[model samples]
Target: METVFIVAAVIIALLLLSLVLVKQGHIGVVTRFGKYHRMMSPGIHFKFPFIDNVFNKISIQHRSIELEFEAISLDQASVNFKSLILFSAKNSDEDTIKKIAFRFIDEKSFMQTLIRSIEGSIRAFVATKRQSEILVLRQEIVDAVKDHLEDSLNHWGFHLLDLQINDISFDEAIMRSMSQVVSSNNMKAAAENEAQAQYLIKTRAAEAEARSIRVKAEAERDALELKGVGNALFREQVATGLAKAGTIMDAGAVDPALMLYTQWLDTMKNVAAHSHGNILSFDGSNDGFDKTFKQMQLINKSLLEKNTH
Candidate 1:
């Protein structure tokens, strides 16, 4: 009874050891005595006990990694870059799985090679471009890296799904210089616009002032012409009235001197009552004030001669 139980327990242990359970999304590569044997899919799989080794499990699902690096441009500018790369197992074929299992010593080695290949390709492309051209050539850089790395990745049983250049920048000094250039351009544009606005405002004001002056001159000319007509009419009426008064006074045999003296006294009373501040200054021109001055002089001489008599 003890011998039979020992044999069954040994057989159960070997059975358990031979059963390999692969997880989802992973493809398992089996090796026999340190040599390639077969590939196993997800689920429980059986292999020769103690002979077949589950060498490596490769994921067929997409994998992504972010990379940050620096490179030099053609003009010796230090350019910094952050990128995202997506890759996966080439396919679930026997050859592809075998290649994936035996390509490199381990996953770390394979990833290092892949990263170096991408970086080297990018640096090579950047070496031919100036610093100013790098931002605009993001797509070109991606394409070049893909083209340079596609075949190599395929040989290792991997597919380069996508390569995205996320952020590209320059060193601090270079970035500051570029920013200043843009700022200066904007300032120049603003200054030009402000100058144009000021010019328009001044021009409009000058035009309005010129128009106002022309209208004022026209109005003054019209007023002066009308005033001349009124002055002539007033002088004619005054002369006619004085002539009638003189004729009436002579017919009635009234003293013309007494009449003149009364008229002078009445004129003085009217001036004293109506003049502002009881003070009046003549214009001193030959138009009206100079003639009034001469008439006053003749009256003063007449008054003096009468008093002397």
Candidate 2:
């Protein structure tokens, strides 16, 4: 009875020790005699008491870490970077879990290797680019690092999900220089735009002035043409009236001298009526009038004889 009781007690103790409860999202790595034996999924499992041990509980869930590091550009400028890295165990498969379990001594060593690999890849890429190109190539830097690290991380049974560069900045002096460069570019653009606008305004003004001068010249030319036409018509009418008067005088048997004297008297009367405060300096005596009239009568008699012929 005593032996049976001792045996029963030992069995109960072994049963209690063999029962293992693995948490969700984690795989239990079992080892026998300090060597990897098998992987246990979440839930209850039975293993030989005192021989089988839970070596490591590896989480298969996604994990994230923040990184801050400095890199030197090709131009010898120091650039600082702030980034986030998301990674996870490649999968929950038996081979992947085994690799995760045996690859590193502990989590600290794994993290160190991971971070250094990322930093090295980033530095290698940045070393080839200038400081001016760094800020704009955030995504490019991430891609270069991921491409470089993919195979290596797969060997460690991990997958890089995402890499986000939160901030990238240069040193203080570089920043000030960049700011001044941008300001000067803006000022140059403004000056160029203002010059173009002024040129357009001047061109438009010159065109308007040319149009106005052309219009004025055209108006003056038209007025001169009309004045010349009026003068020609007036002279023609006067010639026609004088010829008719001469014909009438010949038909009435009137002397040409009488007609000449009458024309002189009419001309004096018109000058007196139209004169503005001006005196007529002409001889009023009959002898002086007869002398001027005799010259006009001789000229009129010659014109009448020519017209009759």
TM-score of each: 0.63, 0.66
lDDT tens readout by residue for model 2, 233-270: 98888768777877798799977677777877898899
Which runs in model 2 stand beyond 4 Å of their true positions? Answer: 1-16, 208-309
**lDDT over C-alpha atoms for residue 135 of model 2:** 83
Clashes of 2: 0
Q: Could you give candidate 1's per-residue lDDT for residues 1-309 as a string of tens digits?
A: 999999999999999999999999999999999999889999999998989999998899999989999999999999999999999998999999888889899999988988888888999999999999999999999999989888998889899999999999999999999999999999999999999999999999999999999999999999999899899999888756655765687699864555555666578678878877757544556666546555655664575466469
- Stretches of candidate 1 exceeding 4 Å from the true structure: 196-309
Candidate 2 overall Cα lDDT vs. reference? 0.90
Candidate lDDT (C-alpha), each: 0.87, 0.90
Q: How good is model 2 by TM-score? A: 0.66
